[model samples]
Target chain A: MPHDHHDHDHPAHSPPQPDDKVHSYYQILGVALKELLIEKGIVTADEVRSAIEKRDQITPAHGAAVVARAWSDAGFRTRLLTDANAAVAELGYPMTTTRLVAVENTADVHNVVVCTLCSCYPRELLGLPPAWYKSRAYRARIVHEPRAVLAEFGTQLLEETEVRVHDSTADMRFLVVPRRPAGTESLDEAALAELVSRDSMIGVAVVRQP
Target chain B: MRGPHDVGGLDDGPIDPAPHELGFWEKQIDGLRGVIGAKVIVTTHENRRYVESLGDDAYETLTYYERWTAALSRQMVDKGLLTQAEIDARVRVVRERLAASGELAPGAEDVKP
Candidate 1:
């Protein structure tokens, strides 16, 4: 009875809201002091730096390659749509944490991803998510009004593409593998990578012709 | 302390908290610190008068920060900056150094107990 009363009183006396500013990305990704010391023993600072650089260079290209292949190869597209993890690995970007879910932006429903629980991004393929992608405004609004959220990012989907909001919970994360843009029929893998921004993969932006 | 996930509709604005560019693990640590700080101050203030009504239990209830600091020290150790032995040694040294200097209050060292 006492515990129940405590729980009841909790909601009635919650504090006023806090600030809306997001934490800085560098502060977010910086190694803990302990980890930094441990890392010095295990690997050189230069080595760690090089590893990060290589990871950054490869993942976006790898993701674009998958998108390009998916555009051309029917079987690969099927595999990507059906099993995003295996498809991503097939293209050589094997992400350990994120569970890849390709939300097809079609004439019907367009899928957008937001981690209401935490920032569960597809870093293995897309690299780091953009600053706005992780903002409190984006996280809270995307779920309720996907179209308006997308509009803020300068992405105006056709009215036909019904906005389907996907929230990343504790266990699983999602990525939106947007429908390949039209007129990109002739572009190569390298060219395609230029068009695939991190925001696009989150379903907030779309690849447009240059 | 507020949970990282509890920042929605904050500051009377509709904007979402921008995601910091840090990697997942780093963000978790920051979130942990925020949560702990929020919990301690809120709890202490909320129960201050209640503790005055029940002296010993109130003191016991106010030991939240001690538990959190201990957990944070353990986390630092687990992350590999310090060994368990080092943390224990550091805690002992800090206690002794403080006590020898008369910095320890009448019951401060007994907070953990």
Candidate 2:
């Protein structure tokens, strides 16, 4: 589950809300391009509408389910680590654009993903990436100092624990399967999935049972 | 030796980590990119290349989707999918309608067509 997640309860931060009253050059351009394309019969209006609807349906929960399954089943975890794309597809969450690489977080090593060039993300399973993921500070500094970035997210790792950062590219994406919290072995898959957050899947925050 | 977009390992400022709800236009632009990619009108790589080529100025000034909108406009022209004149004309029409309905931003008209 590298791409989209449908759940809207983002972990943290409050971004400025878009003002519908103001329309800009690019906004008008976006509208015009879609209209012109539809006017020319290149694509139907219905098609574009449907595409928007479909995008809205995907969210981080999709990735959480995948992580939960991997936590509960060792065989599935093996398959997920071996062939993440096919493993997710078997769960009915197929990769639409890029190849998915599920990186597991062990007690000795923690993994995180970022796109240094641009906002390359697993949009299918993780839904849209958070604005912070696209910010210059996070992009530039994460690779340089992941522990600091992780600390900002309130994730503190032991000194001996290794931090591995994966830079997502145009053709490939990364999803982090966080180590399940202790004392959660009695929980079912559904309950386990509830504990996985978007930030955890992005490797910014670790999964913690409440 | 780094491109404007190659910001990894730079001593940039602290991350805000704020998550804002996307605007309608932002989401629309994203959907347009998705649909256009599905149609094979433009490859995702091409879009990334175009956005990366937007230089330091645009990368600094525009928001995420604004960069995509601007780059997509350039790609459409370069690919001959649409003419600049046609885009401008449609924009003018839409702008006029919005203006008439008093929906334009307070000083959005200050920007050139």
Task: Tell me, by lDDT, which candidate is best.
Answer: 2
lDDT of 1 by residue, B46-67 (tens): 2322322333332222222222
Per-residue CA lDDT of candidate 1, range A63-143, in tens? 667777777788988998898888888877775544677777766777888865335567667665555555556666777
List where candidate 2 sits over 4 angstroms from the true fold: A1-18
Q: Please name the candidate that would achieve the greatest DockQ relative to the true structure.
A: 2
lDDT of 2 by residue, B7-113 (tens): 99999778987677888887888888888899999988899899889877667756788789889989989988899999999989988878788877666654542
lDDT for each candidate structure: 0.53, 0.85
Q: Tell me the tens digit of each residue's lDDT in model 2 across A101-141.
A: 99999989999999998888988889999999998889999
* Candidate 2 local lDDT, residue A17: 33
Give model 2's DockQ, 2 decimals.
0.53
Highest TM-score against the true fold, candidate:
2
User: TM-score (chain B) for model 2?
Assistant: 0.94
